[model samples]
Target: MSRLFGAEPAEEAPSFFLEAPRTEKALERGAAGDLRYGLASMQGWRAHMEDAHTACPQLPDRLARWAFFAVFDGHAGGTVARFCAAHLLEHVLAAEALPGADEEDAAPGAVAAALREAFLALDRRMQALSRAEGWEPAGSTAVAVLVSPRRLYFANLGDSRALLCRAAAAAFCTEEHKPGRPRERERIENAGGTVSQQRVNGSLAVSRALGDFDYKAVAWRGPTEQPVSPEPEVSELPRRPDEDEFLLLACDGVWDAFDAAGLCAFARSRLLLSGDPQEVCERVLDAGLYKGSRDNMTCILVCFPAAPGVSQEALQTECELDAYLERRVAGSYLRTGASRGAAGHPCRLKGSAWAGGREGRPGRIWPSRQASGQVAWSSLQGPFGFSRAIADSCQPAEELSPHTDYRPPRVPLGSIFLRSRRGGGQAPANNPPPRFLRPLSCQSCTRTCCRRKRVPAWWACSKAWPQSQIPASPRAEAWPASKSRAPLPPSPPREHPAVRQPPLILWEWPGLLLREA
Candidate 1:
């Protein structure tokens, strides 16, 4: 058993994988009644494509109003998964006590019982075939959902998962069946099999699967009581068409990449971007691939009538946010020493290190440090041109920390602007100076020392500006550089010149203030 399936630390088992991953994906889509489904499968980093899925929006026979979806994650080989995908539904429909013509007559428990019976029956058939043909040892997870007008039925035999999203939240999710689970471990031990490193007999990872015939060889144990049971755990939930948005049935590969909450959020955001279910499914597969899932991946998304639709407003907002981040990243990269122009600057911040503002605010900034690591302060009228209004906004050096550990407060995005410096200090004829919506308060700044260091009548903290050169405003006195930490002399309140001018916004860039010259 160990030789066929390999031992724990599965990554070391080179026999199960190829030299390189295959990223090709196969996608499918279909719709019936109020349910629309999209399916995507990828070989990923696996040696062969082993995952399979089934999506039936409306089942045939007497249960026309029902929808069925399932995902099978095959291990050792693809035979079991493929067989279940093609024949499981037929077996389910053929169950003697299956839900029939009268919606009211067939109880939910009866429907669940029939589904359980179908799983066991299918396993028996597989065992018979394995005995006759002498097939190689393999097993596959089974996670399926049946959607009727009033209820949803879920069944599971292995670790693949099913999730239902309602009112834009995760309403239901299935638990995985692994040998590590207490009940499953107890059952395995009772059937004379040991679980080591969370694997059955230190080999197969799943506790229950359809075709692991070797584990089902215990003569005294019944089919469901075997170390690796063929019987499935069945469950039912009341269906609410109005509140329910979508249902997700996915192989472990997809689950490994995202939790139920994260998956729901990503799907919702994708739906807002594009309403085509197939495109969304493709994107999900691509994401799972990029997120470093080395297994074959498969997923089915069944969108109910209440599923989210594309929003023009949301799309535009996302585009704008992307553009803003791109510009910031480019600016950060250019300022770093990796650029030819920035080679001389060793204190520059890397492009990837520029984090967005905390608490959902916009813009990125790192506060000034002491004299050794302090930002190279450019003159207001020097090569990096700064307007008089901006220079006037400079806060006293005593107001901020002089240590290298000073961290800056987050600034709102789109609040800061690069003013084009004119030769005669005149505003551009075509473009007026940008007005800041409000002055950023230092009271709530994250840097406690910077906030409590000093309080001035004016409302600006230009940590990058030179204290000796700060232009004195009518409301305050110019702070001398020599006595940077000294207390300021008391002065009477006066009308500020900035009141007549457009409010200027200041942002802390790394060792440099970017401007349009």
Candidate 2:
């Protein structure tokens, strides 16, 4: 009867649960300058270890002043993750945007650009290799940190993350890119794709990744425009020698069990107890396993110069701070419906509110202003009862007030045209319009009004505008006008002999000039 019905005889069912073999625990240690680092990986309940990591005490010859570390969490197979562990740093070293070994003072923006390009290039190479070798579909999430003498740069793709523990609190962490996130979902849909059940197309779990060629088949889309792009989000921050304690880089296997604040506090406690970074890492892996993580676990712990000497008192203070921040963030999220912003800001804590008065004695805790002008909590106390500001010293100056207007002095028109020629000649076909000229609204009337007005299309599109217009190294101007005012009609397009066609303008406001790309 079973054979006639097409049913096979039942055999003993194979158990879905499996335990990790004890032999897979891997560990390594190294040092670079005052930084001591440790790395560890363990195959927890997973059938096989698909996680890979790298820790370099010193980068290749000319780049010896820097160090590199990363964690790659692979799914489906381990090939892509292992490949990244071996070749990712080499690609970064060869990136065109990276400064030469002797370039000690390279611009932060340039360094970040180099890292971004390298990540994309690595993904492209991985795709080409898979196609050539006829490899199966596989991909990995990567989180990397490059430590230079003066700065620390981070790049992340997928859910793997990097975190900085500063002054006994969770300071900085990479944002996870998941299909369910609003921005990630929008990008996927824009590329003619769909997200279901927090996964891309109900199969892949990550929105962005290093190798997964199946999703990269859109012929018209650039690398970044693909639904599962490998392009990483890169950022740089100055090295904070005074307050920076350590850095933690881990794959999702570990992150699934502990949040940024919880992990930092736990690591701090373990570090204080052992003073050995390797031991701290081992303990973290054990903690994750105890928490029932089913994936392969990997983590790297990097102790800064200040870490070894952190007194018992400081450790206690940091734990207190971590607890306090967790409570504050939870309360704020409930009251204001605003989630924690990047770098541990609880509902957008203003810098001025925490800067505190100089007259306040050190080590004294005092109430500071909240977003609503009500006092929220006491300021963090530094070592020996001195008052320490909560703001990170490594924060870029521009971030202090990201919306500050740039004001350039009025300049004559001839120089504006001349400067455009010198600053890179004609703009490229796809060059985006200046921030001031971009459309302000999607309304049809607004678009029509913007098209009717005439401003110097070249002036708005010029790569070097106010600078070229000024005599002798002029500064860029900041247009401070309101962005929502009624559109103003300027001189009609084609008023200049150099411009033949009436340039199309999309939107315009009273104080700002705008043009269509």
Candidate 3:
């Protein structure tokens, strides 16, 4: 039996027979455009509530279309989790790599990089606060989602997870970082830490977390080299309005009780019964509690524009109408002899009539041609109810443009440096530096680095050594000295001889450069 936060190990399992005088439940619900979202949390049988969550339908004013949601499961105490809930999203917004609302080159890889840095920044802030306030050995697992109109970016650390339900199934999920996993275990051991009985150093249960200060005590090692790292694994997927249903983020308490498929099925069934996302989240928490989850439970549900429960009947009717119009277009084209237009191109249903005449006041169908050459059917000007007949007969056509066929850029996994370590001394003359380390144009680096920190053109030492041999530290001296430059800060004290400084490496795509042991 492992102890928590330096607490003495118990010979027998601790009992939580005593229940709280009152249940602690929190709920939030909102909408953004066609999307709807809900969040719910319950303390369950636990003596104290240690779970926290966040929901934002729209980000800061600068990034209006973006939304964010997250769940944090705390162990040892709830302070860490609460802290993360309050600041994680803000940090993400502040990341230098994150794209703006209207940036044309906003690629998925850049968004993923921003997410990774956001998690690391949160961890760093917690660590710094813990040092000053003498906080307890507390930590939290986080799963967060950043939703844009066209894409969804996810970041995960520890056991909390983000899952996507699409086509009536769990289409995507973030992998949990557990100590028992082979790769996680290997990282722990390599960092001079141990995993015994599936617990980190026979204590912490997770391999990666937000604020476990004790596990991060190897001063000679970089942040990622600690027994528990805060670096989140980030991934992105294109949003499919036609097929994607909803996204769910939950703590281990919910996940421990239900697998991805089971939860998606349950949520979908509930959504059909009641179109309210808030009610669905409440039911999910209740289900986790009923299933006997041993820890505090938290869950957040985000419904895409196409998700169930939001006017499903109308959508179905629209689909049927679209099919009918397609058939009508084909039939009319054949009957009208496919007349040629002014430009000698095939005229698409230019003079077709659908039973009614142009003089009809209500319930009349009006045909229009989109720029893409697709035919659209709409109701003629009339009272609300009068248009229903024509609206049900024809569906609106989707607008298309040259950029409509754009797909999410496939970022090469190798391009996002998962782990970058500093080499000892200097590199050999024959070999070139990695692509990421190579000197990029100023504009490229500015766009890539975001706004948080300004990176130098050639991020290397001021000495004559090759750029490849430059130290991995972000604080490396700049090559040029401007007349207006401020004086350099004093160097910190040297480390103890017994503690060796490891090489610095970039970790998880293009975020957070860390030293490795």
Candidate 4:
């Protein structure tokens, strides 16, 4: 089932499960900075949404965030692969954050330990269930990665593999851990298993993994008698600051279609036309299907390029302050009866706002007084001054423990537009507050109302006239009265002399002024 509101129907492909005695699955989050993943199932070689992901927008820096993908190839059934999908990374991260774990340190044995524990835990639970359900232990091949800013921990069990493509470099390029490796062969032998022609017990193809409990049994009868060691060959590579390129983790299904180098070359070529990882992923799927993969095919592509930095921290601060003003403009804290006119002190401003000051929440946010970094009577009284004054630093309202204090970074008021006085000019220190800010209706707003811009229109029927307040008459250009940032509107429109529209005067005035004045 698709999670999206109107998702496209999932496509069905022939199973490569038995095609080359391998399977594959692919997942791509793309360069758009999204989080998505998928798993291929044994039946029909169909893809399953085993686990999906959502990107954390709070941390926009790609380098600061972590991303990884995996592919689990199951031969007998998908029980083991499905189990690993849900729990492998779970155990690794738990191990990464282990007590006294140094972020920089590879935490060498932690991954292996986590792998052993995770697999043992799963095996125990699976055995109990398999006994209850009367089903034999199902096995799977696992290949996965856990990536961070400084390094990646790639681990594999069984035949599924993980490959890396160095930036602009050519090669299948990744360490392969298979049953043939001396250490792997030894591990199996030491556990009382035989390896011939790189196959465990001369039958199973992988040396390490979870759920093959029956094979590990010294006595082929029960859990205590036989158990899968599930010790993954884990490698921690301390990456150069910018050495990251792209990574691929695929089940044998994809390899059956494209050799190790062929898969890497295919991924490299697609990235040229479009950097869409999803498209490249589909291309891998197409390749596998084209090659007649009979088992489930799953491939997961993880690319760490960069993230979009459209709005800077400066812009976010600006927008945050802008949104703050919206609360003031809404008169959030003032009641209807608080208006100066309603209080019968209209013309002469009064300061009755302080009457209800201590009634509600003591630190209640108000549109007429100061509270924390909120707008204040002082700011409204000056039209262009900040509540706490520009020189003041952030301070907590009360002393918590002597060791703990709540304070924000010293925000530099810098060049925030205060308020406007005469039409478009700055409000002077001595000018009386606007009628809106009188005692009964003291309006305390952070952003100046004059920051709005009004661009000029070319054609003018009444419909053509600009909607916002114009800087020049109703017939002219408009701009943020308080901001000098924008250039003045283009010299009044150059209109033909025969144009008789008043609203079009600005458009026609330029030529008329040039010709006559």
Candidate 5:
């Protein structure tokens, strides 16, 4: 039955994927001297967010000349990641491994040693905390970098990554510590563990990380030689301010979607579009979701004095692209007949879904200003600056419904374009838009699935189509927006008669619904 409907085998599916992803992002931005940084994180398609980061533009007291940044990608649970983000810097500073205020001339090796000790120290502290708190078995991959005026010190314990961009390209990146790596595998085997299917003992995917006391139970061996060692690999590189562009740190969530060179180019192009580092980081997270990554995503982008700048030409080109999309959307409405879709059904293009609103309610969103018949486009504004004229002209007041049938603007498949303003050149064909452009409304009811990349869950419409293949009334009264983060009501379990009787099947076409006979 599963094969006939093309459902993924239950065993092969990821253990933590949700029916839909949460698209909201957490953004932070700051600047210090020639160093400016932006950080963005999203819980994309994961059951829980487990990614955390640290960014200190200036270290305290005598260490003010140095800047610290790191990303932690947690697995099994989020406790370790949050703990590391809050305390890793303090531990690093207290290690006294770095050059003193008077030792400005200390060799780069000193910095590397200091970072290594810091990672080990943090792991040791976490071990004690885990026992005290009685935490569930969990661990986190950590990748960090310390930047001084003269050099960079990189350290890592697992698969999280950091990259350095120079001359508009990827100059260097840290190596990932996967369990399958030759050296990593040898260590695991010596520690009485086996590597199978690229995982340690067919379990953990990474060879090193903080926490995971279960793997540190080798009483005869030292902590550093355990199956899953917490000791980090550290390296040092001389800084090249003349050619260096920026530094990027991210968890596997972002790396799973891009290679070092590809990500560098993508980040550079976004920087050209907007000099705001936070926006650039948001774009990276969005792109990662579009590329089908199923993890908690976090990214930190630190720009140097030589980073790319926004260009007038690129901005103009972007505006033109927006105009083109608007024209196409308008023409599509005209061709399909005003306020209707291609199949003669009333178009369900609910504009309110484009903005923040109640999580489980459809056609209800926060208003920037009260307008009797039309929603204010200002509140729904995105990076593209979609024109109000086009939206208003295309959608009549009567056409706004709780249920959304998202038909993307009829533009060419590869029509989207991006250019680097600094280089004054066009980028290669990449960054196709995600399938769904806005949150989806249930075709049978008013419930909302507030995600841009995945289909609405079956339960979103279950109240109306409880046990029938027939469609129910699609009309619903819009509710006033509320400021709340409350969880949506749980749907009936899969074994319930309503669900078991006739399985709800998600059709391949975006926003379309079908019921299995």
Candidate 6:
């Protein structure tokens, strides 16, 4: 019964990698829900023979509400690339307990520590993989994103880039971690690996990787030299409620073909048209290969739709949206702002509320409605909530205590109807409690936090929004105010239900590597 609304902690890992067409370790995803990959160990070219791609199916906002992804570039060999594909995200998300992981990992510093451990853990994991394979040839370069409705974390190792095209025009992205950076080069050298003119070992191009056991030591560490830490070049970029755009993760192959402007331009030109990530990847690759990339070329494009509520409604229920919300059918108040209060409907928000779910505060009485319909969704704090940590000492008793936690957040700003789009929605039916409430049955809706912390209570705190302060205006607002005065964008074509959005699940990876000179 307890398992339904609970989610297992997310063990994130590295992601997809594609190499030269020769060894072609290609992984591509299409309309199919499965991620198709083929690796040919064809002697000399086999390692570079394939590509890596995956098509993720979209889930109901109740499940996946965030956009999460990564890209790995295999150097020296495909080991790191393959390893990353197999396990990077898992390691990153799992290292939350390693040294320096804060009790309340809520700040940028704590996040950085987590990233550091994640990178070190990646090195450790790859070293183990190398030991298991009883050889080297299992390394990779990685770049990943941990995205949530409120924040974003972008981490990386090596020259692979993670570019964020702001929702607005004329905005560039975060700095690239390339050999061109002095500190990056110093880090490579300080690790005992020579940064020959900014490049690791003065031979390979990237400064960081997972499994380049061969180029790892300064000089094979003679029989007595200690091995160096092939830790990653990890960084953090916090995502705010405002200013979000598409992301680009790709091997140098793709970048070599397109400059920052070029890549953004190309992706932006076609993004809204396809709305499918893997297809965007394929087109990018096709563009790169055509541009004559001699190296292994791989790329991943993650597009965050600009539309609100249903984000163009991929799955239009025959039932009125109201019926589905269990509304259109009696006694309801604060429907939209209901879940935003200090405490909310345990079961409902456990279904969709910032992806924290019951993990937020078990035993805490959720906010609710007495009668009549009204808006409910608001920042966990307040209406003008700048929305970061505010040390909730003022919280009511039975509040979910502060603790280090992780929840694979659903998409950013997931579309939830605070009130009927129709406006001044109908009263909701006071339906009897469900005959069966199996917590384990609805794993997607279950909050993942309950697993680590031992909670002994479940309470509901249905407070109301203050509309009394509204001055005499032309029209009273719907509350929360969509954050924007304008309406959401046009609906995307539902021509291919199979091409639905991909689940924002955490992934796993192997180690790092160096595939080129």
Residue 480 deviation, candidate 6, in Å?
59
lDDT per model vs. reference: 0.62, 0.60, 0.59, 0.42, 0.63, 0.39
Q: Pick by TM-score: which candidate is best?
A: 5
Q: Which tens-of-lDDT digit does each residue in 435-463 have in candidate 2?
A: 21121211112232334322212222212
lDDT of 1 at 494: 33
List TM-scores for all candidates, in order: 0.64, 0.58, 0.57, 0.45, 0.67, 0.45
Off by over 4 Å in 1: 1-14, 330-517
- RMSD values, in order shown: 17.7, 23.6, 28.9, 24.9, 14.2, 24.8
Stretch of 10 with least lDDT, candidate 2: 355-364
Q: Candidate 2: misplaced stretches above 4 Å?
A: 1-23, 102-104, 308-517
Give me the runs in candidate 5 sitting further than 4 Å from their true place.
1-15, 102-104, 335-517
TM-score attained by model 2: 0.58
- Residue-wise lDDT of candidate 1 within 171-243, one digit each (tens)? 9899988898899999999999999977899888889999989999999989999999988888889988789
lDDT of 5 by residue, 1-517 (tens): 8899998777865657665567688999998868999999999778899999999988888877789999999989999999999999988998876787755677647888888888888888989888998998999999999998878888988888999999988999999898878999999999999988788888888899998889999999998899999989888788899999999999988777677877788788778878888888987776565434667899999999999999788778667755664454444323322221111111233221222112222222211122233322331132223421111011112221111111112111111111111211111223211112222322222223322212242323222211211111111211212221222432322332222111111112112221111
Candidates 3 and 6 compared: the better one by lDDT is 3
Ordered from best to worst lDDT, the candidate numbers read 5, 1, 2, 3, 4, 6
Off by over 4 Å in 6: 1-47, 50-67, 97-108, 168-180, 188-193, 218-229, 238-243, 307-517
lDDT of 3 by residue, 1-517 (tens): 3455777775776654222212357888998867789888878666678899989988878788888999999989899999998999889888898887764577648888888888888888888899899998899999988888788888899988989998878999998888888888988898899988778998887899999989998888888878898988888888888999999999987776567777787788667757778887876765554333546788899998668874576557645754653454334433332332221101111332111111111111123222333322221111111111122111111221111121112111121111111112234444322211212111112222322122222211111212111211111111111222232221222222221111112211112121111
In lDDT terms, how accurate is model 2? 0.60
Q: Report the lDDT tens digits of candidate 6 across residue range 481-515.
A: 22323222222222211211111111000011001
Residue pairs clashing, model 2: 362-385, 362-386, 363-385, 363-386, 363-387, 406-478, 407-477, 407-478, 408-477, 408-478
